[model samples]
Target: MLRGVTHHITATREDGTVFEVSYGYGARQRRLLACLHCDWEEQITYGGTRHKGLDHLAQAHGAVGNPTMTADARARRQVLWTMAICFLISAVILWWATSRT
Candidate 1:
């Protein structure tokens, strides 16, 4: 069975403390969020997990900063960019071919 892709959101304090929250869908397609610094987790049936994670970091850990996505999320975004470029190229080629014919 293929595993679901997991992405992490990290926050840091000025004191150099770091906190991370991982959010992703499970094998059964249930959305899950878990904090790396503590025993805090939630199976989200609705709403956004990112806000929840940010809230946790700010409220529980007092770590406030612009959260950053981990490599997995960046890779996913890269895939989207690649796909959009490929689609645009194909559209242009199709338009050129039809114009010639």
Candidate 2:
């Protein structure tokens, strides 16, 4: 419910039944999925968000056609590169200290 923190997915069945799925970072950056219609909330331990959303829609409401969505690949790559750079810098520092000793 915080602005820009959660992603919401909604699917409506032929009889106008609504199912809502929300994805967000919970405590310790763990991914979580919540349903608005019932008491069904769980941690996303594996698989993609869209797959889980669509499956929930089908099983609960018999609705379909929610496209498979994924996180931004460019952003993910950027994060990976940043981590690699930090690791390289730490390795160089350790090497220099060892060589001097």
Q: Write the per-residue lDDT of candidate 2 for residues 3-55, one digit (tens) a residue.
A: 22477766657874546677887777788877777666677788777678767
Residue-wise C-alpha lDDT for candidate 1, range 6-96, written one tens digit per residue: 7667666678566777887766887888887888877778876778888888888987746454564456556768988999999999999
Which regions in candidate 2 have their CA more than 4 angstroms from the true location?
A: 1-5, 68-101
Task: Choose the strongest candidate by lDDT.
Answer: 1
Query: The CA-based lDDT of model 2 is what?
Result: 0.68
lDDT of 1 at 31: 82
Highest TM-score against the true fold, candidate: 1
Return the TM-score for each candidate structure. Answer: 0.56, 0.54
Clash tally, candidates in order? 0, 0
Error of 2 at 41 (Å): 1.9
Candidate 1 minimal-lDDT segment of 10 residues? 1-10
Provide the overall lDDT of each model, using Cα atoms, as 2-decimal numbers: 0.73, 0.68
